[model samples]
Target: MPSTLRSSRDRPFLPKIKKSFTYHSTTNRGLTGMKSKGKMQGKALFYWSILLPALIVMLWLTLYPMITVFLTSFQNYNYISGRRSWIGLGNYKNILADQVFLTSFKNTIVYCFSTTFLEVLLGTVLALVFYGNFRGKSVFTILLILPMMLSTMVVSSVWKTLFHYDIGLLNTILSRIGLVRVGWLIDPHIALWSIVLVDVWQWTPFAFIVMQAGLLSIPQEVFEASVVDGASYQQRLLRITLPILKDQILLLCLLRTIDTFKVFAKVFALTGGGPGNATETTSLFVYREAFQYFNLGRSSAASMITLAAVVLMSIFYLRKMLNSKEA
Candidate 1:
């Protein structure tokens, strides 16, 4: 009877050991699962922590303003009277038909193209001339770059004085040469060109510097090899130099085009978009509508139009670049 009791107790002890082992195994599996899930959560939290602030700031600063401007373009909103009303496409239609806006847009196109082309051409020539260093080259270069280095406002002020119809230095010089005093800024026909002259004088240095750097970057061996192959100077220039500097020229054109398209300071300070509307650009027109007349709706529409023009120009430049790359 005592031996039977001992066997039963031993059987119950084995079952208890098996139950404890199974409980420990299940606990370990659950802990491993929690650890893996925690690691994934931590990684996701780290990335979101970095990206969230920038995303929020961009939404506030850039996206919000763009959306506001887009919506406002279609509304007749006056900041002064605190009056707002939906205008549909009326603002766009009015600006498109407005004579002042049309003139300003035309002037901007003429000024941008003329100044960019002439400045790039002149800069390329000057860069080529200075390619072979000689006496006084450094001094000459400093003098040449002085115009662009000066502040635009200061340049405009001085040029404004110089362009005075009667007592200006240019008119005085013309009188000395026994010629009629020409109206540099007064005449409607010549006012836009006068702005172009100021822009070219101030920006040609930038183009020159770029072209010079491009010329310097060309390998000397290539030129020497062309010479050894008996290529003429003009042939070498056409075949080797201009091809290499094409990208620099195009880059300068792109920058100058955009800057000139948005020209306001020179027109405001020198010509006041005037004598008539000769030197007016889209920027001045937009400024007048938004600030002077308090026509926010039309102003926004003109702004969008200007933006579209700039975008189209950028697209054109990008397409040209892509074509060059593919070639």
Candidate 2:
């Protein structure tokens, strides 16, 4: 009992020390909030720095060109002669009156619709066939995707040779089968279809891949439940599978439609819009007017028209897709 009092260091949990610590907790929280604000500001700066350059590039590459084309479409401009004059809607009128433009537009529509339909049908069927595991599935899938993997120009060149009217493999087989030696790329009636065939061969694989991805995403448990509930294979496919794949099919058609609508290289390589322009397309029409003839005004007008049509079609499909997504 000599010295009963304890030092503050040994009694740190005393009321006075506890009150002192509680008074400083607000300061600690204030420091933490300041640090968090500084970090958030730094992150915002970093993100803006990355996004600013991309936005500038997009303006230069896309926005500027689109604006220039829209303005030039109303002017009579000759690229080679460097002559430009305001012509109002003269270029559009002239193009609309041209039979060549009419034919090209018609051919584009036909190609877009026909190829999209066939590709969708074939892709859906093939995806279903290859949905389940099978023997040699890897090899078959690799072979199937090869056509889409190859360069478009190379594919066009190879198909051009194979579709030659004389001494081509296709013609040789047709002759062997006692079929007439048909003109694949030369006949006006069949030239467009020939290009379609080449496109189908090259791009059907893309559609097939898309459809297969959609098919494979379906849960196996869902299918098993359907089977256990007394659903037949066909019933499950129609009632369950097809309904789930509607969006994929629609998206595939949209992509194919856009690609086929702008067809140029195939027609240029295979037919050169020959046989009186059977395979002529809107893209080809625009290209020849701009480069070959140096008619920038008409070219711009034709391009604008084509763009408007594409925009309308895209709007329709995109609305459908968005609606489907919302549903």
Candidate 3:
């Protein structure tokens, strides 16, 4: 009878052990699945945390203002009244008809193209002249880049004094040299060119710096190889150097063109858009519209137009870069 009681107790304990083992195995499987899921979720959140802030700031600063300006361009907005009404293309039509605006546009294009072309040409020449080191090379380079180092507003102020019709340094020097003094800034016919000259003086250093960097990056062996093949200076420049530096040239052109298109402080301080309207640019026009006349809607439209021009120019530059990459 005692042996039968022991067997019954043993049987019950065996079933209990098996049940506990199965329960513990299930618990372990559940914990492993939870850990794996948590790790995947943590990795996803980490990447998002890294990218989210930049996206938010870009949207706030760039995207939001762009949308506002685009909407404002189509409205009739008065700064004084704070009134806005849809005006369709009225601002564009009005600006196109305005003679001052048209003159400003023409001046802007001429300034951008002429300055960019001449600067690049002069910069390339300067780079070539300074490519090989000599005594005082560093000093010469510093002097060359001095004009670019000065603030544009400060440079404008200095040039404004220099360009005075009679008492200016330029006229004084000309008089001393037995040449008749010429009007550098007073005459409407020559005011635009005078401004262009000042721009070139201030910005040529920038172009020189860029070109010098491009020149320095070229492999010395390539030039030696070309020379060994009996290539002339012009031939080596044309075939090897220029091709390698094409992208740099294009980039410089794009930057200078954009900057020249927005010329204002020099025009404002030096000529105030001219002895006539010769030195006015699109940026000056927009400034006058927005600040002088308080024509908010019209200025917005002009801003959009300027933005469009820049975008188009950027597309052209990007296409050139892409083509170079493919080649």
Find the candidate with the highest TM-score and give its number: 2
Q: For candidate 1, lDDT tens digit of each residue in 56-162?
A: 99999988877787788999999899899998999999989999999999999999999999999999998897775667766777787899889889999999899
Tens digits of per-residue lDDT for model 3 on 25-74?
44434544666877767766877899999999999999998888888888
- Model 2 root mean square deviation, Cα atoms: 16.7
The candidate, 1 or 3, that scores higher on lDDT is 1
TM-score of each: 0.81, 0.84, 0.82
Residue 204, model 1, lDDT: 91
TM-score (C-alpha) between model 3 and the true structure: 0.82
Task: Give Cα-based local distance difference scores for all models.
Answer: 0.83, 0.83, 0.81
> Which prediction has more favorable TM-score, 1 or 3?
3
* Candidate 1 positional error at 118, Å: 0.8
Candidate 2 per-residue C-alpha lDDT over 57-153 given as tens digits, one digit per residue, 9 for 90 to 100? 9999999998899999999999988999999999999999999999999999999999999999999999888776767776788889999989878
Better of 2 and 3 by lDDT: 2
| Model 1 TM | 0.81
